[model samples]
Target: MSTFRLAARVLGLAALVALLAACATGPRITTEADPEADFSRYRSFAFYSPLAIESRGYSSASSERMKAAARAEMEARGYVFTTEKPDLWLNINAYTQQRTDVTSMPTVDYAYYYSYRARGYYVVPYWRDRTDVHRYTEGTLNVDLIDASRNRLVWEGIAVGRVGRSGDAAERGARIDGAMADIFAQYPYRAGMVPAPR
Candidate 1:
């Protein structure tokens, strides 16, 4: 594989990890992560993931599949799904900035002039990298695990990364799963939960 392709895959994995690990402060946590809490209390839920995920190497169909995978993974972790009869509602939103967001305007660059012996005229050749800023969109995905019974946000996790212009169905699923897993890494919904002793 080409270096760039390899880089993309490696970077893709790294982005997934980074996004999952990057957490945003969510609503205050009221329950303890210990065995004392009853997850059944806030069981049924609904969550919206990117309907646009499947369209690059990722197509729209892929997005639907990605959502399914995310839902499935969450379900395996004990959360039940329900739209009309949900105790908790999940809302997923994303914010992205194109590579251009970090780019500057083009500037004139000097070039060495080479003279042609026959014409005695010098010409300077200049060109820019067609893909000067071969870009990616840096974005944040926010997952709100809200409590419908209370009508307030209960848990929130924001995953952040620079998503390349190209993502396949596989990549999308990997990212979604990786991100959600990271969010739930702090599960049981404890307030100010810290990692246990090393």
Candidate 2:
């Protein structure tokens, strides 16, 4: 292959690898739990709808997806979902912010100037400053586990990452699922834990 063509192919491969890495990236997760609380005592959970409303305007579909993911994870840890008086209440809150980054880059180029005395083209090297603007949206999701009777937060998990605005419903759902899984992986309590097979 020609040298130029080979260089182009290498650049293309690098760009493709970067894109895949970004797509596979998951949200950063942080979790905290009350050390005094008895996690083993919690047996049932119910969604705290009022807290969801207090957070802000969130789509029902998205809320349902998050709740469902949480529900599945809780069940795996030996928790039951109940509408009646429950041992724990689950609440989710999400918000997004717009971020803008501006960077100045130095650029070097050659300029051609006409000189009557030289009777030839003169090349001049000059440096210019170029500004790059990057705009993106960052989103954060907080999952809180509250003691129903005490009305106190027992545990909280948060995940933050860059939010993709243009994706199909299925893609968005998958992202939500993945984020929830990551958040739940931080849960401090596990019922009947077993070692994984190699």
Each model's C-alpha lDDT? Answer: 0.54, 0.82
lDDT of 2 by residue, 105-198 (tens): 5555568899999898987766677787989999898999998989889999999998998669998898889898999999857644432333
Candidate 1, residue 55: how far the Cα is off, in Å: 17
Model 2 spans > 4 angstroms off: 1-24, 53-59, 112-126, 191-198
Candidate 1, residues 2-52: lDDT per residue as tens digits? 544554675577568658845642322222233332345665677533233
For residue 39, give model 1's deviation from the true position in Å.
6.1
For each of the candidates, the C-alpha root-mean-square deviation to the true structure, in angstroms, is 12.0, 5.8
lDDT of 2 at 46: 90
Kindly provide the TM-score of model 2 when superposed on the true structure, using C-alpha atoms. Answer: 0.72
* Residue-level error in angstroms, candidate 1, position 147: 1.3
